[model samples]
Target: MGRIVRVISKDASVVCSAIDGKDIVSRIEEIHKTSAVVTAALGRLAMGTSLMGFGLKGKDDSITVKMDGDGPTGALICVSDSMGNVKAYVQNPVVELPLNDKGKLDVRGAVGSNGTLSVVKDMGLKEPYCGQVPIVSGEIAEDITNYLAVSEQVPSVCALGVLVNPDLTVNCAGGFLIQLLPFAPESAIDQIEKNINGMESVTKLICGGMTTEAIAMKALEGLEPNVLDDFEVNYRCNCSRERVENALISLGRAELEDLSKDGGTDVECHFCDKKYHFTPEEILGLIKE
Candidate 1:
């Protein structure tokens, strides 16, 4: 099971996750038959979303992370809820790109750096909060970290990792978020920088059998980290036929009439590749209500 760990130290608060998601990402690749490079790009976004999503304080609260870039990967979108459930979809899932200078997946090439990262949070309020920041790097983690620092006015260190195997399945995936509290001292910042500089790759740690808590402990060097919460996260989609039906009804009479000329309408859920069909008779029934 994939697990998200929330912890706190005297100087800071952190969220770390070691998601066992080979099966989940495999299903995603199967759904889209994403190229290895695209899979890495999408997988990193999924990991980053879960780390942010599990921070919602309410049961119905949710967060969406979206990036509109100039690259062929189109837009990357992920929706996550307070319960640690997440779903992801890409506008163009089959983007292919050459490796970067590091001989790693060229995520920045797949998702151009000259774009914007937008975050929307719904907290069961009359109006949700929205923040946008220029894509500092299309590397997922750095972009999100930059978003928090610039848009939210919070200093955060975020790292995300996704390792795609030769067969295009995710081998392991994980991430960690370290936020410096307002009252944190300068020593705390310097200490963390030293720790991070000496630390190893997070996904590699999870691959080598380290738990999320251990990673959290490694992040907080001088301060003692206390595990506050632990829960399972998943690539879960809440889409259903009822939601599709409601959406169809929202199209109004004119749109429904035009759709009826085509005999039927086929709508596919972006989050999950589920397709829903509505016949002309159904459209007529929906418009009447």
Candidate 2:
């Protein structure tokens, strides 16, 4: 299990949320069997999406973050519920590329800058809210930062990192999101900027034995930070055989009739690779219903 913490400045000038998602990312890698570069790219995206989902106010509210880039990784999608349970997958999980000039995993090369980053929020409303922004950088962190600033009108700083071991396992993965509340004082803004500039990458801090609360405090240093709440998060998919059956039932009588003639079929979930098998009798029953 991973941990997530929410912190706020004493003066209420800033709010920051941080997460240590190493375990979550590890589970994702295990399920997706992603290559090194794809692991880093998808890991960062999942962490960022979890942080955003943690801020939802309603119990049933959910968010989906999608990166439709022109890079080799193709489109990456992550869905998170209000409680910070996230499930993510990449279109091309095995795509690999040479490290960039920085001698780091080529996340940018794997997730190209030529596409759009879109977010959809389901808040139990008639119509879900959607936000879209041009991918500022192929790096997932900058793209999220840009989405918040442009689409949400909130000045924010998002930092995400994932360190993959030589054997393609996750070493550490985490991130922090700091947003300036409305009418934030100039002094607090400057201090937050200075603290971020001086701090190391989030993965380094986690690898160095820093917890989510400690990372949150580090981001809000010099501002009298206080932890509001903390909780455990995991890479959980709510998919089940029943849900898959219902989805197949929605395909209408014509589609069900055709499927019933096929003897049997296996349906694989996108988020989790769990397969649900439906026999001809099951399909015929659905068609009759």
Candidate 3:
């Protein structure tokens, strides 16, 4: 099963929240079935969203993250609930990138350096809280941290990573988020910063067989964190033929009539790249009804 762990790391003057969602990212990567770089970016974003979403307070609270870029990837979107459930997709997932200097998938090249990352939180309210920040690194983790600091006014350190195999498969994927609560002590901040800078690559740690709990613990060594919860997540989509039909019907009677006269229509899902066909008769019926 896909695994995800959330922990609250605290020292005398600071409290840090860290989430490691390795397996869940990998599972989502599998569904995209795209190029290595695309999968890496998607996986990283998914992991980041899951981590952030799981950090919410209300039992039924949820968060949605959207990245609409000027790059070939077009847009990257993901949603996560407090229960650690996450779903995400890219508008164009077939784009590939030349290997970077490190001989690894170049996620920034695929995601583009220009765009915006927006987060919207739903707390079962009439209007959800929204925050947006300009994309900083396109690498995902840094952008998330930037969102927290600039948009939400929260000081945070977030790191997300995904290693893609030469065969275009995922080797490892995970991330950690460290948030500095308000009025945290200076020494606590210094130690946590040192720990973060000295820590090994998150992907390497996870691929090396480190559990999520263990990774969080190592990052929070001196700090004592009260374990909150652990959860398993996977790639899931809420799309269906019914939803597609509703969208098409929303085109109005005129468009439906035109489609009926022409030979119906064909629609493809941007998320899953699946197509649905509609017959002319069906279009006519839709227009009539």
RMSD of 2: 1.0
Best by lDDT: 2
lDDT score for residue 144 of model 1: 89
Candidate 3 lDDT, tens digit per residue, 1-289?
Answer: 5666656655434444444555566666566677878888888888888888877889889899998877788899998888667888888878866888988778888888898999999998999999888888888888998999999888888888888777876777777777777877777678778888888998888788888788776767777766666777666555788898888878899888888777778887765567888899877666545
lDDT tens per residue, model 1, 183-283: 87777788789988998987788789887778877888567777878877778889998998899878888998899889988989988888999898877
Off by over 4 Å in 1: 11-23
Better of 1 and 3 by TM-score: 1
Candidate 2's displacement at residue 185, Å, is: 1.2
Q: What is each predicted model's overall lDDT from 0 to 1?
A: 0.81, 0.94, 0.78
Descending-lDDT candidate ranking:
2, 1, 3
Q: What is the per-residue lDDT of model 2 for residues 121-219, given as tens digits with 9 covering 90 to 100? A: 999999999999999899999999999999999999999999999999999999999999888999999999899999998888999999999999999
- Which candidate wins on TM-score? 2
Off by over 4 Å in 3: 10-23, 58-60, 261-268, 273-289
Model 2 poorest ten-residue lDDT run:
280-289
Between candidates 2 and 3, the one scoring higher on lDDT is 2
